[model samples]
Target: MLYPSNYVNKIIYRIKWVTQKNIEAVENKALKKEELKEKIRKNSSVNG
Candidate 1:
């Protein structure tokens, strides 16, 4: 009854939180990769 509802809500909230965190982490990693690629491109063009 009441306990089950509370437990379900808590579980859902935690799942949502973890999912959002994982999405954000992936987005950040993609951004860093892009930045590194840009840096490498710039350096290669300079040396070549």
Candidate 2:
């Protein structure tokens, strides 16, 4: 059986694309967590 020359490369490219998307999602979550921590600190300082 013969396959197209770039078929394997295309598959790898798709996998990379999916991984990048997941990484971005996690990064966004971490950023939000940091922002929440900052807000809590500010609120506690103001109240105390």
Candidate 3:
């Protein structure tokens, strides 16, 4: 039996795209948390 190569390539590409998007979302959440921590530290230093 023979199969079309393009169909396999398309599935691989979609899986890769979804994996990359998930990684980016996790990274963005981590970055936001770090920024919040820095802001809190600065505020506490000024008030103290």
Candidate 4:
């Protein structure tokens, strides 16, 4: 089997872009979780 260089490059570029997006999404979710936890802790301390 054979493929053109440009075609292979396009596929590699797309894969890299998709992975980068996924990594960013994961990071954002983690940050959101941390923010939520902090908010809950603050509220609890204020009440108590």
Best-fitting candidate, scored by TM-score: 4
Give the C-alpha lDDT of model 3.
0.97
lDDT minimum window of 10 residues, candidate 1: 1-10
Model 1 agreement with the true structure over 1-48: per-residue lDDT tens digits:
356888999999999999999999999999999999999999999999
Which pairs, if any, clash in model 4? Answer: none
Residue lDDT tens for model 2, 1-48: 867869978988999999999999999999999999999999999999
Per-residue lDDT tens digits of candidate 3, residues 1-48?
756999989988999999999999999999999999999999999999
Q: Name the regions of candidate 2 deviating beyond 4 angstroms.
A: 1-3
Per-model CA lDDT versus the true structure = 0.97, 0.96, 0.97, 0.99
lDDT of 4 by residue, 14-39 (tens): 99999999999999999999999999
On the 0 to 100 scale, the lDDT of residue 40 in model 3 is 99
* Ordered list by TM-score, greatest first: 4, 1, 3, 2
Per-residue lDDT, model 4, residue 11, is: 99
Between which residue pairs do clashes occur in model 3? none
CA lDDT of 24 in candidate 4? 100
Error of 3 at 7 (Å): 1.3
Q: TM-scores of the models, in the given order?
A: 0.89, 0.80, 0.81, 0.96
